[model samples]
Target chain A: MDRKLKEAIASKLMLLATVFSSLLIFAVVIGLIQKSRPILATHSLSELLLSSSWFPLRGEFGFYPFIIGTIWVTVLAMLFSLPLCLLTSIYLAEYAPAKIRAFIKPLIDLLAGIPSVVYGLWGILIVVPLIKDYVAPFFGYSATGYCLLAGGIVLAIMVFPIIIAVSEEVFRAVPHEIREVSLALGATKWQTVKHVALRAALPGVIAAIVLGFSRAFGETMAVMMVVGNVARVPSSVFEPAYPLTALIANNYGEMMSVPLYDSALLLSALILLLVILFFSIAARIVLLRIERRVM
Target chain B: MDRRKIEEDFFKGLMILSTAIIVGILFAIVAVVVLKGAPALSLSMLTQTPKGGYYLGKGGGILNAIIGSLYLAFGATALSLIIALPVAFYLREYASERFANFVRLSLDILWGVPSIVYGAFGFIIMLYFGLRACLLGGIIALTLLILPIMTRAMDEVMRMVAFELREASYGLGSTKLEVVSKVISRQTLPGMLTAVLLAFGRGIGDAASILFTAGYTDYIPHSLFDPVASLPLAVFFQLGTPFPEVQERAYASAVVLLVIILLTSVSSRLLTKRWSRFVIK
Candidate 1:
């Protein structure tokens, strides 16, 4: 009887796990349906997203600028961050002494755990003032640096750890024998790193950089704080801009215009979701091909 | 050779310089926050209620907020573990066939779904079920939020306990439950704790979800039904007005949040280090 009871309990537990997994998929399906429901009403969903004016309250809802803004800030952030992160990762992975690497690594990891709100606080108090007073006007730009320039700069800082940590993992994964052979052939440390180590880890590094791009693309809190939350094409690199994540965060609270507002917000979210899924899948496919070739 | 040497030196210098810049951003953020947050720090500000003014001490103690954040996070973590641990153990120890693999892949997609979107889902659905603006609602929301992580981490840990170990325990007449409770959980205690700590940290930092459900208040929570203040809410609510004093408290609270994160990270590092050493034998 005890053995039978045990088996019954075990089976029940497994069923519950199955149910929880099903529930999560159910959630994604609901969110997708909410987003895609607008297709029933509109012939041209592209225009809904592509129109520049986003007056959802007046019923002319266009999420174009927000999408553009998100892409702009993210592209700018990647432009600023990628090269810097690559060089830094190479330094830590190839050049840093054991003691220093151990010491500095956690500090970077600590940055990962620090809440987005704290970064927002820093952006407001320090970044905004510096921008308002100095940066924007200096470049014959708007009255603030709380634009693409400031937001991208801060985002690069925020995502720097991810780039370094992931790229370092990839760099470490490169077979030592390849580096060994290169060194034995009298290739210098830099040459072996440049030609062999980095080459071997290039796909993984691409994965890391792409993930960083997606993060910058989807970031909300700090960008909301530093970008002055303006919805205009940047007058200059120093001029303020809005992004899709910031739009969702900033506007979700007071959007009471029924289906129109909900439809617009959900559509943008769906687009952002698609963007993330695309990059993630692309990275996996690319890495799989690379891994096969290496094997 | 000379040109190559020059190029190498320049590249190395740039790498070191950029890394310094990255580290500098961390320092600069901390310094700026402390500079703004310090003058506002006082006994009453730490412990009093808000009045007016854009600068100096003006608000109530952040004590309630701190306490609320702690209880909610703890409650949420407990809920997540309760829901996730049994499920994980069942999945790993008993389940068979392609269905299990399919379920696992779905869990991965759930992991990628944004936290804000989850918040949106919870706000609408949880409210419909009468779980509205209460700590219980917040706790439930956070449980769902952290469940995927807890289960995935725990599942991996349980599976890493070798078949031979379980066999040896069975040879000594231990049942499956005994093997799980005594052997697996004990062996994987550090990994389990790390996962819990990570979930706790995420819960503490979370704001978007709570902004919709766990409505903010200044008063201390007298019952689970009472709406409560948390660090994230404190920061979010203060952003509306132009009061410098309230805003500065937001910075101090931000500092406190960072401290909580730092402490959790440090503790987890220590725990994992000790566990790896324990496993080396």
Candidate 2:
């Protein structure tokens, strides 16, 4: 082919690829909705989402317990990870010596690199037994190792790298000149961070936290292994519960033969996709706005 | 005055303490995985497939899962690259800034879509096509899972290729394709390699997306249509069984996975260092 024709064809191919990727999210959503039409046809959307009954074999597919369980674990994980991540990010961005910061950077990468399944194995081996033998007992509750609390703890560790990485960037993005001004005004280093850096980075930090929340919310295998897989609303941290991701992961194999069972699971996945997509988009928007303002 | 001093010291200590705790947990996870897994790691575990009654703690190894994981991840990464590279190039070279930004935003959202969603989506497509859970289906699912990640990573590096080089190429009567293929691709090759390795690591270790789309089997797959097992599912299945011996093998699988990831990350770092010298600043 001539160079011009070659160029035109290559450009068209590239544009086609771009269009394909751009439309993939829609394809996923539409495909899910189509697959899940059977369950939706039988039950109202609200009924699927709100009712707590979950007899998959008998055609009941209330996702309330799984939704609530996801909320419980995600919120609890945020509660555990946020303060530590914030503090650690603050230290890394502002206080840690350069060498320590360098050392911790790769450490965070390694933490993030460790597969979720390995994290799940770690949870089962260490966090679960610790919760069962020590933490729960100390709190005056006898418990199995697998529960909402174990899921939360494992998820907290899982989300630590994301939160810390993002928040550290946000904190660092607060200009050094601003901190100098605070110091010039006779503020302590802590006071400078409290009044200047943290205040300036609050939106970005919130965005980071939301990103972490979305990640924790969608996490599957790790949470599934530790969270007891019980289908119910967990009233306490020590109680077993099934999050939506776990519900789908645990049931996908067996659900195929049963009528509408796979559809229900797909609907649950749809819910997961929709929820995570919303949060992720929102967080990305916030982070983008922050980046624009900083620039 | 005393209160201010105390507050500063207290908050500073808290920050340091939190950092220490986070670091401690990283070490703890590795230590536990290594401690529990090393004893179970053996040549047979790497060389042999699970025998009959393997889940019953009979004589067997996870060679099936090991080979299966390699096939799936490698296939997925290659498939993702074919699409991801072109899309990334178009974003960086041909598209207008506003369009590029919009696509980047979409890619970011897709990146966060849970792996399970991809699995379900893949399964749905399989159902429509009268396909089974197999190696091809798994690759399709994982390609979707990693496509955004690879594209974004490549796009980030391409964006770093100085504007001056592109302009210079244009001055020499180079078409957009020539500038992209000859100038940009050569410069960003290392970053592209690293991104490939990164996606491969992710694809190899992920269990969720492939859980439904790639049905597990004890035997190593001989064809793309065959069901394939993976290391993550190996660990998950073994741990679910009541046998202690089987559970121990789960830890061994984890060790293998962890080592692969670590090697991927380390080699990427080394590869970047080695190749980056040829890259212009």
Candidate 3:
């Protein structure tokens, strides 16, 4: 094709892609503009947010149980993933010899590339049975190993790669001069890392962790597979529970066309979007705040 | 120094332990998926449909779903590349700061929008405009899901083409289009292709948007307006099954999806690895 023809064709292609997504966004904008009328709740939105009852089949759609379940699992997953991902990132970024770092980084890369479903199958086969027989029963439970512990434990494993990759990048982004500055101050290598390079990258580290949180919260398949999909507020960490993402992924296929059911699903999705958006914005804000402090 | 040695030893132990565990999980997951899925792979499984394409049934392989995923993803990627590049070029290369920021934030929010919400949005559009869970709906929805990544990637490629080189072209009395299209865009063709492939990777790996929007199909898609299935949806629907054989197939399908994503990401990263040269006069 002539240059004009090529440019014209390329422009047309770009037009098509933009228009495709434009249509979807237009649909979402319209839906937002046409909000359903608000229903009066005797309980406040806070109560609705905090209550743990999830009896959707019993004409009750309080999603507190699912939210709490999601929160506990997500929190625990982070608690486990954060330290490990940080330590690994530090090893890759600072401590490891060049050849060793090069050798090991691809493994982390491969871990990042694997899809969530693979982890779900592993959890079901390995983690669930182990939890059921060895851990849950020891804490006084039946043979059902699928519980918050199993789900949370596996979720930690799933997010480790993301945290390491992002945090490693952030750690590398710390200025060379900062390390020189720390060394000039007579600090040891570990002291420079702990007091200077890591401190410099703290905002980005926080951002990566928050992003990991959102990823864990948004994850559906693996958690849905292993969480056992129980709706009651988890009485303990060993009990089974549902997460918001898993709830939508599991129930949407067989929702039986109930109006409330559809609305409730939308509500949960909206809440998830808001929660992720909230964390994203919060991370940006935190970074901005850190920048201002440095300024 | 003694305490430091102990601390180093402790941290080293922690690092090796954690890294080994992470690597072990990845290997274990792959092995387990194969162990579960290998027996379910058969010739008929490749050629036949699953129990009328419902996850509740046991007999049908993902023949149609596999074909459907390819068609919808191919269509979506093609559509997205056609549309997203200029918008990205316009915003990143040509637009003012405020406009670019607005577009960037819009796409950032778009990327953050839940897949189910996107499906819900697609449903509203489909119902309102007489579109259904056919290839068109799925393509459009997947296009939306993929656009942010494409635009972002393409913009990065354009930005890396060097401002001084573009300025030199413009200083030679060339029009802005000549500088942008003939000079910058040409220099970054490989990068742009990587961008397109990356978007395709994300588009093909999705399950939730297709779950409601693409609907399901047990036959080859003969028209762009027909309901279709994709690999992620096939894996998803199959994983929900109670049948052991079908569940195994789901793992195999997931492994396939993971492999595709893995190749895409690694290839994109490899393609974009670059070095910069500076001149002094």
Output per-candidate TM-scores for chain A, rounded to 2 decimals: 0.91, 0.95, 0.85
Task: List ranges where model 2 is wrong by over 4 Å.
Answer: A285-295
lDDT of 2 by residue, B97-213 (tens): 898888888898888888988999999888989989999999999999999999999998888899999999999988889999999999998999989998998899899999988
When sorted by lDDT, best at the front, the candidate numbers are 2, 3, 1
Superposed Cα deviation of residue B162, candidate 1 (Å): 5.5
| Ranking of all candidate structures by their DockQ, best first | 2, 1, 3
lDDT of 1 at B177: 65
Superior candidate under lDDT, 2 versus 3: 2
Q: Residue by residue across A1-295, what tens digits does model 1's lDDT show?
A: 6966886786687678667764775675576556557742762677766777777656676677787778778887888888888988888888888887887788787777777677777877777778778876676655655777778877877778878888988998888899999989977777788899988998989888876776677666777878877876665677778887777777766754455665566566667767776776677779889988977
lDDT of 2 by residue, A1-295 (tens): 4878889999999999998999998899999988889999999989888999998778888999999999999999999999999999999999999999999989998898888999999999999999999999999998998999999999999999999998999899888999999999999999999999998998889888887887899999999999999988887899999999998898887887899998899998999998988887777778778768866
State what share of the real interface contacts each candidate retains: 0.35, 0.77, 0.32
| Candidate 3: residue B69 Cα off by (Å) | 1.4
Candidate 1 vs candidate 2: the DockQ winner is: 2
lDDT of 3 by residue, A116-178 (tens): 666777888899999988987786877588888888888998888879988999989888998
Can you give the DockQ of every candidate in the order shown? 0.46, 0.81, 0.36
Task: Give, for candidate 3 chain B, the lowest lDDT window spanning 10 residues.
Answer: B272-281
lDDT against the true structure, each candidate: 0.73, 0.92, 0.74
Comparing to the true complex, what docking class would candidate 3 get? acceptable
| Cα lDDT for residue A148, candidate 2 | 95
